[model samples]
Target: MSSHYGQFCPVAKAMELLDERWTLLVVRELMMGSRHFNALRRGVPRMSPALLSKRLQTLVRAGVVERWDDGNRVTYQLTEAGKELEPIVEALGRWGTRWIPELGDEDLDPHLLLWGMHRNVDLEAVPDGRTVIRFLFPDVPAPSRRWWLVISADGVDICDEDPGFPERVGVEGSLRTLIRIWRGDLDWAAALRSGTLTLDGTAQAQRALPRWLKLSPLAGTPRPYAAAG
Candidate 1:
Protein backbone atom coordinates (compact mmCIF):
# COMPACT_ATOMS: atom_id res chain seq x y z
CA MET A 1 0.00 0.00 0.00
CA SER A 2 2.80 2.43 0.86
CA SER A 3 4.58 1.61 -2.41
CA HIS A 4 1.35 2.11 -4.39
CA TYR A 5 0.90 5.52 -2.71
CA GLY A 6 4.61 6.40 -3.06
CA GLN A 7 4.24 6.65 -6.83
CA PHE A 8 1.58 9.35 -6.55
CA CYS A 9 2.66 12.20 -4.25
CA PRO A 10 2.91 13.24 -0.61
CA VAL A 11 -0.75 14.27 -0.53
CA ALA A 12 -1.68 10.89 -1.92
CA LYS A 13 0.48 9.16 0.66
CA ALA A 14 -1.25 11.13 3.40
CA MET A 15 -4.62 10.20 2.00
CA GLU A 16 -3.52 6.61 1.70
CA LEU A 17 -2.87 6.63 5.41
CA LEU A 18 -6.05 8.48 6.41
CA ASP A 19 -8.62 7.87 3.71
CA GLU A 20 -9.93 4.47 4.73
CA ARG A 21 -13.70 4.74 5.23
CA TRP A 22 -13.82 4.90 9.02
CA THR A 23 -10.23 6.08 9.62
CA LEU A 24 -10.88 9.81 9.24
CA LEU A 25 -13.97 9.50 11.39
CA VAL A 26 -11.97 7.71 14.06
CA VAL A 27 -9.50 10.59 13.92
CA ARG A 28 -12.36 13.06 14.15
CA GLU A 29 -13.68 11.40 17.29
CA LEU A 30 -10.22 11.43 18.85
CA MET A 31 -9.86 15.10 17.90
CA MET A 32 -12.94 15.77 20.02
CA GLY A 33 -10.78 14.39 22.89
CA SER A 34 -12.65 11.18 23.56
CA ARG A 35 -10.08 8.59 24.71
CA HIS A 36 -12.13 5.52 25.55
CA PHE A 37 -13.38 2.77 23.25
CA ASN A 38 -17.04 3.31 24.14
CA ALA A 39 -16.73 7.07 23.82
CA LEU A 40 -15.33 6.71 20.34
CA ARG A 41 -18.15 4.26 19.55
CA ARG A 42 -20.70 6.80 20.77
CA GLY A 43 -19.09 9.50 18.64
CA VAL A 44 -19.65 7.43 15.54
CA PRO A 45 -22.71 5.40 16.45
CA ARG A 46 -22.95 3.43 13.24
CA MET A 47 -19.37 2.16 13.33
CA SER A 48 -18.96 -1.46 14.23
CA PRO A 49 -16.54 -2.28 17.03
CA ALA A 50 -14.54 -4.60 14.79
CA LEU A 51 -14.18 -1.93 12.13
CA LEU A 52 -13.26 0.76 14.68
CA SER A 53 -10.65 -1.52 16.20
CA LYS A 54 -9.23 -2.22 12.78
CA ARG A 55 -9.05 1.47 11.91
CA LEU A 56 -7.38 2.32 15.22
CA GLN A 57 -4.79 -0.37 14.65
CA THR A 58 -4.20 0.91 11.14
CA LEU A 59 -3.74 4.43 12.49
CA VAL A 60 -1.33 3.17 15.13
CA ARG A 61 0.67 1.30 12.50
CA ALA A 62 0.79 4.46 10.37
CA GLY A 63 2.14 6.41 13.36
CA VAL A 64 -0.88 8.72 13.34
CA VAL A 65 -1.97 7.55 16.82
CA GLU A 66 -0.35 6.21 19.91
CA ARG A 67 -1.97 3.73 22.26
CA TRP A 68 -1.31 3.92 25.99
CA ASP A 69 -1.86 1.57 28.87
CA ASP A 70 -2.31 3.51 32.07
CA GLY A 71 -1.69 0.85 34.72
CA ASN A 72 -4.91 -1.14 34.32
CA ARG A 73 -6.60 0.52 31.35
CA VAL A 74 -5.98 1.45 27.71
CA THR A 75 -6.60 4.70 25.89
CA TYR A 76 -5.94 6.07 22.42
CA GLN A 77 -4.70 9.53 21.52
CA LEU A 78 -3.46 11.34 18.45
CA THR A 79 0.26 11.66 17.93
CA GLU A 80 1.76 15.07 17.15
CA ALA A 81 1.41 14.47 13.41
CA GLY A 82 -2.18 13.37 13.92
CA LYS A 83 -2.94 16.47 15.99
CA GLU A 84 -1.82 18.53 12.98
CA LEU A 85 -4.80 17.16 11.07
CA GLU A 86 -7.20 19.20 13.20
CA PRO A 87 -7.62 21.92 10.58
CA ILE A 88 -8.31 19.37 7.88
CA VAL A 89 -10.91 17.65 10.06
CA GLU A 90 -12.52 20.98 10.91
CA ALA A 91 -12.69 21.87 7.24
CA LEU A 92 -14.41 18.57 6.50
CA GLY A 93 -16.86 19.22 9.32
CA ARG A 94 -17.62 22.69 7.94
CA TRP A 95 -18.25 21.14 4.56
CA GLY A 96 -20.51 18.45 5.99
CA THR A 97 -22.46 21.00 8.02
CA ARG A 98 -23.11 22.93 4.82
CA TRP A 99 -23.82 19.99 2.56
CA ILE A 100 -25.34 17.03 4.46
CA PRO A 101 -29.04 16.62 3.85
CA GLU A 102 -31.52 17.30 6.59
CA LEU A 103 -32.21 14.09 8.49
CA GLY A 104 -35.77 12.79 8.67
CA ASP A 105 -37.71 12.46 11.93
CA GLU A 106 -37.03 8.76 12.22
CA ASP A 107 -33.37 9.48 11.55
CA LEU A 108 -33.06 11.99 14.38
CA ASP A 109 -30.93 10.68 17.21
CA PRO A 110 -30.42 13.40 19.84
CA HIS A 111 -26.99 12.14 20.81
CA LEU A 112 -25.75 12.27 17.23
CA LEU A 113 -27.32 15.71 16.78
CA LEU A 114 -25.57 16.99 19.90
CA TRP A 115 -22.30 15.45 18.74
CA GLY A 116 -22.57 17.36 15.49
CA MET A 117 -23.22 20.61 17.40
CA HIS A 118 -20.28 19.79 19.66
CA ARG A 119 -18.07 19.70 16.58
CA ASN A 120 -19.04 23.19 15.42
CA VAL A 121 -19.44 25.23 18.62
CA ASP A 122 -16.75 27.86 19.29
CA LEU A 123 -15.20 26.69 22.54
CA GLU A 124 -13.47 30.02 23.19
CA ALA A 125 -16.80 31.85 23.02
CA VAL A 126 -18.10 29.79 25.92
CA PRO A 127 -18.00 31.87 29.11
CA ASP A 128 -14.68 31.49 30.88
CA GLY A 129 -14.56 29.40 34.08
CA ARG A 130 -17.92 27.79 33.32
CA THR A 131 -17.60 24.06 32.67
CA VAL A 132 -21.17 23.12 31.90
CA ILE A 133 -24.28 24.27 30.02
CA ARG A 134 -27.72 22.80 30.41
CA PHE A 135 -29.64 21.97 27.24
CA LEU A 136 -33.38 21.65 27.86
CA PHE A 137 -34.77 19.45 25.18
CA PRO A 138 -38.46 20.04 25.64
CA ASP A 139 -39.15 18.00 22.56
CA VAL A 140 -37.27 14.92 23.67
CA PRO A 141 -39.43 12.11 24.96
CA ALA A 142 -40.13 11.65 28.65
CA PRO A 143 -37.38 10.51 31.06
CA SER A 144 -34.65 12.17 28.98
CA ARG A 145 -36.13 15.58 28.24
CA ARG A 146 -33.27 17.57 29.77
CA TRP A 147 -29.58 17.34 28.97
CA TRP A 148 -26.93 18.71 31.33
CA LEU A 149 -24.08 19.47 28.96
CA VAL A 150 -20.66 19.49 30.61
CA ILE A 151 -17.93 21.31 28.72
CA SER A 152 -14.30 21.10 29.59
CA ALA A 153 -11.88 23.89 28.67
CA ASP A 154 -11.53 22.09 25.36
CA GLY A 155 -15.27 22.61 24.61
CA VAL A 156 -16.00 18.90 24.34
CA ASP A 157 -18.37 17.23 26.79
CA ILE A 158 -20.20 14.10 27.71
CA CYS A 159 -23.72 14.60 26.31
CA ASP A 160 -25.41 12.56 29.01
CA GLU A 161 -27.26 14.75 31.50
CA ASP A 162 -25.24 15.75 34.53
CA PRO A 163 -27.31 15.73 37.72
CA GLY A 164 -25.47 18.69 39.27
CA PHE A 165 -26.41 21.73 37.17
CA PRO A 166 -29.40 24.04 36.74
CA GLU A 167 -31.16 24.42 33.42
CA ARG A 168 -29.51 27.25 31.49
CA VAL A 169 -30.92 27.40 27.98
CA GLY A 170 -34.63 26.67 27.62
CA VAL A 171 -35.13 25.84 23.92
CA GLU A 172 -38.76 25.51 22.89
CA GLY A 173 -39.16 23.76 19.54
CA SER A 174 -40.08 20.44 18.01
CA LEU A 175 -37.47 17.73 17.65
CA ARG A 176 -37.33 18.55 13.94
CA THR A 177 -36.39 22.16 14.56
CA LEU A 178 -33.82 21.13 17.13
CA ILE A 179 -32.32 18.75 14.59
CA ARG A 180 -32.30 21.51 11.99
CA ILE A 181 -30.46 23.92 14.26
CA TRP A 182 -28.04 21.29 15.49
CA ARG A 183 -27.27 20.19 11.94
CA GLY A 184 -26.62 23.80 10.89
CA ASP A 185 -29.75 23.89 8.74
CA LEU A 186 -31.45 26.66 10.76
CA ASP A 187 -29.83 29.90 11.80
CA TRP A 188 -29.89 30.56 15.52
CA ALA A 189 -30.39 34.27 14.90
CA ALA A 190 -33.30 33.70 12.56
CA ALA A 191 -34.79 31.22 14.96
CA LEU A 192 -34.61 33.83 17.69
CA ARG A 193 -35.93 36.56 15.39
CA SER A 194 -38.88 34.35 14.45
CA GLY A 195 -39.53 33.45 18.10
CA THR A 196 -38.82 29.81 17.38
CA LEU A 197 -36.02 29.55 19.95
CA THR A 198 -36.46 31.08 23.38
CA LEU A 199 -33.29 31.46 25.45
CA ASP A 200 -33.22 32.25 29.15
CA GLY A 201 -30.02 33.01 31.00
CA THR A 202 -27.87 35.85 32.30
CA ALA A 203 -27.43 38.66 29.79
CA GLN A 204 -23.91 37.53 28.95
CA ALA A 205 -24.95 33.92 28.66
CA GLN A 206 -27.90 34.87 26.46
CA ARG A 207 -25.55 36.91 24.30
CA ALA A 208 -23.17 34.00 24.09
CA LEU A 209 -25.82 31.50 23.06
CA PRO A 210 -26.36 32.64 19.49
CA ARG A 211 -22.70 33.17 18.83
CA TRP A 212 -21.96 29.73 20.19
CA LEU A 213 -24.58 28.23 17.93
CA LYS A 214 -23.94 30.31 14.83
CA LEU A 215 -23.47 28.45 11.55
CA SER A 216 -20.72 29.36 9.11
CA PRO A 217 -22.22 28.73 5.66
CA LEU A 218 -25.67 30.26 5.27
CA ALA A 219 -28.47 27.69 4.98
CA GLY A 220 -30.84 26.52 2.20
CA THR A 221 -28.30 25.60 -0.48
CA PRO A 222 -29.12 22.11 -1.71
CA ARG A 223 -26.61 19.38 -0.86
CA PRO A 224 -25.05 17.73 -3.90
CA TYR A 225 -24.91 14.36 -2.14
CA ALA A 226 -28.38 14.64 -0.71
CA ALA A 227 -29.15 11.06 -1.59
CA ALA A 228 -25.88 9.54 -0.41
CA GLY A 229 -26.54 6.48 1.67
Candidate 2:
Protein backbone atom coordinates (compact mmCIF):
# COMPACT_ATOMS: atom_id res chain seq x y z
CA MET A 1 0.00 0.00 0.00
CA SER A 2 1.17 3.50 -0.82
CA SER A 3 1.63 5.85 2.20
CA HIS A 4 1.89 9.07 0.27
CA TYR A 5 0.17 11.93 2.14
CA GLY A 6 1.15 14.38 -0.56
CA GLN A 7 4.58 16.04 -0.54
CA PHE A 8 3.91 19.74 -0.33
CA CYS A 9 1.70 20.92 2.54
CA PRO A 10 3.43 21.24 5.90
CA VAL A 11 0.38 19.97 7.78
CA ALA A 12 0.31 16.83 5.67
CA LYS A 13 4.02 16.38 6.21
CA ALA A 14 3.56 16.78 9.95
CA MET A 15 0.73 14.27 9.93
CA GLU A 16 2.97 11.88 8.10
CA LEU A 17 5.36 12.17 11.01
CA LEU A 18 2.62 11.48 13.48
CA ASP A 19 -0.90 10.08 12.74
CA GLU A 20 0.19 6.56 13.52
CA ARG A 21 -1.68 4.14 15.81
CA TRP A 22 0.08 4.81 19.10
CA THR A 23 2.44 7.64 18.14
CA LEU A 24 0.08 10.47 18.99
CA LEU A 25 -0.73 8.85 22.30
CA VAL A 26 2.94 8.66 23.19
CA VAL A 27 3.19 12.34 22.46
CA ARG A 28 0.14 12.98 24.60
CA GLU A 29 1.72 11.15 27.53
CA LEU A 30 4.96 13.10 27.14
CA MET A 31 3.01 16.34 27.08
CA MET A 32 2.17 15.69 30.71
CA GLY A 33 5.88 16.01 31.61
CA SER A 34 7.08 12.42 31.69
CA ARG A 35 10.74 11.97 30.71
CA HIS A 36 12.31 8.69 31.75
CA PHE A 37 11.71 5.72 29.46
CA ASN A 38 10.17 3.62 32.25
CA ALA A 39 7.93 6.49 33.29
CA LEU A 40 6.74 6.88 29.69
CA ARG A 41 6.12 3.15 29.45
CA ARG A 42 4.07 3.22 32.65
CA GLY A 43 2.06 6.19 31.47
CA VAL A 44 0.82 4.43 28.35
CA PRO A 45 0.09 0.97 29.73
CA ARG A 46 -1.39 -0.25 26.47
CA MET A 47 1.89 0.28 24.62
CA SER A 48 4.74 -2.18 24.65
CA PRO A 49 8.32 -1.12 25.47
CA ALA A 50 9.67 -2.27 22.10
CA LEU A 51 7.10 -0.25 20.16
CA LEU A 52 7.54 2.75 22.42
CA SER A 53 11.27 2.72 21.78
CA LYS A 54 10.73 2.64 18.01
CA ARG A 55 8.21 5.48 18.14
CA LEU A 56 10.54 7.55 20.27
CA GLN A 57 13.32 6.95 17.79
CA THR A 58 11.10 7.96 14.89
CA LEU A 59 10.18 11.15 16.71
CA VAL A 60 13.80 11.86 17.57
CA ARG A 61 14.84 11.38 13.96
CA ALA A 62 12.20 13.86 12.85
CA GLY A 63 13.47 16.47 15.35
CA VAL A 64 10.12 16.49 17.10
CA VAL A 65 11.66 14.78 20.10
CA GLU A 66 15.09 14.89 21.69
CA ARG A 67 16.71 12.08 23.62
CA TRP A 68 19.12 13.27 26.26
CA ASP A 69 21.61 11.63 28.60
CA ASP A 70 20.98 12.88 32.14
CA GLY A 71 24.11 11.59 33.83
CA ASN A 72 22.92 8.16 34.86
CA ARG A 73 20.00 7.67 32.50
CA VAL A 74 18.43 8.70 29.19
CA THR A 75 15.22 10.68 28.77
CA TYR A 76 13.03 11.96 25.97
CA GLN A 77 11.30 15.27 25.54
CA LEU A 78 9.65 17.32 22.83
CA THR A 79 11.72 19.88 20.99
CA GLU A 80 10.63 23.45 20.32
CA ALA A 81 8.92 22.32 17.14
CA GLY A 82 7.33 19.39 18.90
CA LYS A 83 5.80 21.59 21.61
CA GLU A 84 3.62 23.22 18.98
CA LEU A 85 1.54 20.10 18.67
CA GLU A 86 -0.10 20.61 22.08
CA PRO A 87 -3.30 22.03 20.61
CA ILE A 88 -3.67 18.98 18.41
CA VAL A 89 -3.30 16.69 21.40
CA GLU A 90 -5.78 18.73 23.43
CA ALA A 91 -8.27 18.56 20.58
CA LEU A 92 -7.86 14.82 20.41
CA GLY A 93 -8.48 14.54 24.18
CA ARG A 94 -11.64 16.60 23.96
CA TRP A 95 -12.95 14.42 21.16
CA GLY A 96 -12.14 11.25 23.06
CA THR A 97 -13.84 12.46 26.23
CA ARG A 98 -16.96 13.37 24.34
CA TRP A 99 -17.31 10.29 22.15
CA ILE A 100 -15.57 7.42 23.88
CA PRO A 101 -17.94 4.94 25.42
CA GLU A 102 -18.18 5.11 29.18
CA LEU A 103 -16.13 2.53 31.08
CA GLY A 104 -19.52 1.47 32.47
CA ASP A 105 -21.19 0.88 35.88
CA GLU A 106 -18.96 -1.39 37.94
CA ASP A 107 -16.98 1.31 39.72
CA LEU A 108 -15.15 3.30 37.04
CA ASP A 109 -11.42 2.78 37.40
CA PRO A 110 -10.65 5.71 39.70
CA HIS A 111 -6.97 5.60 38.91
CA LEU A 112 -7.41 5.80 35.15
CA LEU A 113 -9.98 8.55 35.51
CA LEU A 114 -7.65 10.36 37.86
CA TRP A 115 -4.78 9.87 35.43
CA GLY A 116 -6.87 11.41 32.69
CA MET A 117 -7.87 14.23 35.00
CA HIS A 118 -4.34 14.71 36.25
CA ARG A 119 -3.42 16.12 32.84
CA ASN A 120 -5.52 19.16 33.65
CA VAL A 121 -4.70 19.60 37.32
CA ASP A 122 -2.11 22.01 38.69
CA LEU A 123 -0.26 20.01 41.29
CA GLU A 124 1.37 23.12 42.73
CA ALA A 125 -1.99 24.51 43.72
CA VAL A 126 -3.01 21.61 45.93
CA PRO A 127 -2.78 22.37 49.64
CA ASP A 128 0.52 21.65 51.29
CA GLY A 129 -1.18 19.34 53.81
CA ARG A 130 -3.54 16.39 53.59
CA THR A 131 -7.03 16.74 52.09
CA VAL A 132 -9.77 14.31 51.25
CA ILE A 133 -12.30 14.86 48.46
CA ARG A 134 -15.25 12.53 48.30
CA PHE A 135 -17.08 12.06 45.02
CA LEU A 136 -20.79 11.32 45.50
CA PHE A 137 -22.21 9.88 42.34
CA PRO A 138 -25.96 9.93 42.84
CA ASP A 139 -26.69 8.54 39.42
CA VAL A 140 -23.52 6.49 39.62
CA PRO A 141 -25.14 3.80 37.47
CA ALA A 142 -24.13 1.49 40.29
CA PRO A 143 -25.68 0.64 43.64
CA SER A 144 -23.38 2.89 45.63
CA ARG A 145 -23.43 6.66 45.87
CA ARG A 146 -20.10 7.30 47.55
CA TRP A 147 -16.41 7.10 46.71
CA TRP A 148 -13.44 8.76 48.36
CA LEU A 149 -10.52 10.64 46.83
CA VAL A 150 -7.65 12.00 48.85
CA ILE A 151 -5.23 14.59 47.52
CA SER A 152 -2.02 15.72 49.07
CA ALA A 153 1.60 16.53 48.22
CA ASP A 154 2.05 12.88 47.26
CA GLY A 155 -0.77 12.66 44.64
CA VAL A 156 -4.36 11.41 44.37
CA ASP A 157 -5.58 8.72 46.73
CA ILE A 158 -8.65 6.60 46.03
CA CYS A 159 -10.53 4.62 48.64
CA ASP A 160 -13.83 2.87 49.17
CA GLU A 161 -14.37 4.51 52.59
CA ASP A 162 -13.49 7.92 53.95
CA PRO A 163 -10.16 7.96 55.75
CA GLY A 164 -11.80 9.85 58.66
CA PHE A 165 -9.55 12.80 58.19
CA PRO A 166 -10.23 16.38 59.25
CA GLU A 167 -9.64 17.79 55.78
CA ARG A 168 -12.46 16.08 53.91
CA VAL A 169 -14.49 17.86 51.22
CA GLY A 170 -17.65 16.44 49.74
CA VAL A 171 -18.66 16.92 46.13
CA GLU A 172 -22.18 15.83 45.25
CA GLY A 173 -23.08 15.22 41.63
CA SER A 174 -23.60 12.65 38.93
CA LEU A 175 -20.67 10.67 37.58
CA ARG A 176 -20.92 12.54 34.29
CA THR A 177 -20.68 15.90 36.00
CA LEU A 178 -17.74 14.71 38.03
CA ILE A 179 -16.05 13.59 34.83
CA ARG A 180 -16.80 16.92 33.17
CA ILE A 181 -15.36 18.90 36.04
CA TRP A 182 -12.30 16.69 36.13
CA ARG A 183 -11.76 17.13 32.37
CA GLY A 184 -12.08 20.95 32.64
CA ASP A 185 -15.02 20.85 30.24
CA LEU A 186 -17.03 22.61 32.95
CA ASP A 187 -15.55 25.14 35.30
CA TRP A 188 -16.35 25.03 39.02
CA ALA A 189 -18.42 28.19 38.93
CA ALA A 190 -20.48 26.96 36.01
CA ALA A 191 -20.94 23.53 37.53
CA LEU A 192 -22.11 25.12 40.75
CA ARG A 193 -24.42 27.54 38.95
CA SER A 194 -26.03 24.79 36.91
CA GLY A 195 -26.40 22.65 40.05
CA THR A 196 -24.63 19.82 38.36
CA LEU A 197 -22.06 19.74 41.15
CA THR A 198 -21.72 21.03 44.69
CA LEU A 199 -18.90 21.29 47.19
CA ASP A 200 -18.70 21.35 50.97
CA GLY A 201 -15.56 22.29 52.90
CA THR A 202 -13.31 25.15 53.86
CA ALA A 203 -13.71 28.07 51.43
CA GLN A 204 -10.01 28.11 50.73
CA ALA A 205 -9.91 24.40 50.02
CA GLN A 206 -13.07 24.56 47.94
CA ARG A 207 -11.68 27.43 45.89
CA ALA A 208 -8.37 25.70 45.41
CA LEU A 209 -10.04 22.64 43.93
CA PRO A 210 -10.55 24.18 40.51
CA ARG A 211 -7.11 25.75 40.31
CA TRP A 212 -5.45 22.52 41.36
CA LEU A 213 -7.09 20.61 38.52
CA LYS A 214 -7.12 23.19 35.74
CA LEU A 215 -5.67 22.22 32.40
CA SER A 216 -2.23 23.46 31.51
CA PRO A 217 -2.07 25.29 28.19
CA LEU A 218 -0.51 23.40 25.28
CA ALA A 219 2.06 25.90 24.12
CA GLY A 220 4.93 23.74 23.03
CA THR A 221 6.33 21.75 20.15
CA PRO A 222 5.22 20.33 16.84
CA ARG A 223 5.53 16.59 16.53
CA PRO A 224 4.41 13.92 14.14
CA TYR A 225 2.09 11.11 15.25
CA ALA A 226 3.11 7.56 14.45
CA ALA A 227 1.47 4.24 15.35
CA ALA A 228 3.23 1.50 17.26
CA GLY A 229 3.88 -1.47 14.99
Q: Compose the digit string of candidate 2's lDDT tens values, residues 55-128.
A: 99988988889999999999889998789888888887656555553445553444445555555556677766
**Which candidate wins on TM-score?**
1
lDDT of each: 0.70, 0.69
Q: Candidate 1: lDDT over CA atoms?
A: 0.70
Tell me the lDDT of model 1 at 42.
Answer: 86
Provide TM-scores for the models. 0.64, 0.59
Model 2 TM-score relative to the real fold: 0.59
Candidate 2 error regions (>4 Å): 6-9, 41-45, 48-50, 71-73, 87-112, 119-126, 134-167, 172-174, 187-208, 215-229
Worst 10 residues of 1 by lDDT: 220-229
